[model samples]
Target: MVRRIETDRLILRTVTVDDAEDIFKWASDPDVNKFMIYPLHKDIEVTKEWLRSRDIDGNDEFDLGFVLKETGELIGQGGIFYKEDLDAWAIGYNLRKEYWGQGLVPEAMKAIIDYVDKEKGIHAIVGEFAKDNSKSRRVMEKLGMTYWKDCQYSKFDGSATFDAYLYKREF
Candidate 1:
């Protein structure tokens, strides 16, 4: 089930079908999807399908919509995916270009990380970013995760791949 989390200026809650339009606003941005593994969304239909298929069972993963409390607008999304190979939760997020560099990611993520640790009984969390995505790298560092190693990631279809740096935090 989707859970609701409140921070100083934002709310982290499970995404729903109604959020399709807002999510598409960022999901469709080429600049936003540059380093993302998923292909740029061509239309709102694709985003709707993704939001519809997104799992909210709180099992292996959870995707949340980051809502700005001041305007109740969906600014972005963030979540933790369980990596079975590493036996740890991997954190990820994306935001609209307009909201970039505002330090909003760590605010939303800090809440998610805390929730995972307290509720899921997980002590280790990992984050990865494309080697050239320095913006994401900074966000990871601000989250107190340290550089762990370099790794390669590819889309499910194996059509595209890139080198990435892994960051880790263990409590």
Candidate 2:
């Protein structure tokens, strides 16, 4: 089972279709999705479909929603999933633009890293982001991840592309 995680300001737990409207708040925002692998959700149905497509019940991958503990507001979502091509796990996250620069993502990520390391016996994981995403790079740095290489990644629909940087950390 994917464990529920709590941090100083947030709770990270599996997100479901029931959370679609709340998730759409950020999933539909272009600024929030500037580097995402998926296209901007055009409607609530799109978000609902996307959520339904996730591997929410799988033990090896977690599709989590981050909720503010104080307000019970779902700010964003992220997850760690095993990548067969890399033989490792990849981590990704996003937050509401209004919550940026609050150190919340890192706090949530730290708890995830700890859980996987101690409970899952996983030692390493990687994160990659668009080269121009300085904020995401800072989040990787804050989590003690080091730059690994550069590559190109594009949206699944091929609508946009990015020059990307990959980072990795070992426990």
| Number of the top lDDT candidate | 1
| Clash tally, candidates in order | 0, 0
Residue-level lDDT for 44 in candidate 2 = 97
The residue ranges of model 2 lying beyond 4 angstroms of the native Cα positions read none
**Cα lDDT, model 1, residue 44:** 96
Candidate 1 local lDDT, 1-171, one digit each (tens): 968999999999998989999999998999998888888899999999988887788576867899999999999999898899998899999999999999999999999888877777777889988899999999999988999999988865566798999999887
Find the 10 residues in a row with the least total lDDT in model 2: 114-123
- Give candidate 2's TM-score: 0.95
| lDDT (0 to 1) per candidate | 0.89, 0.87
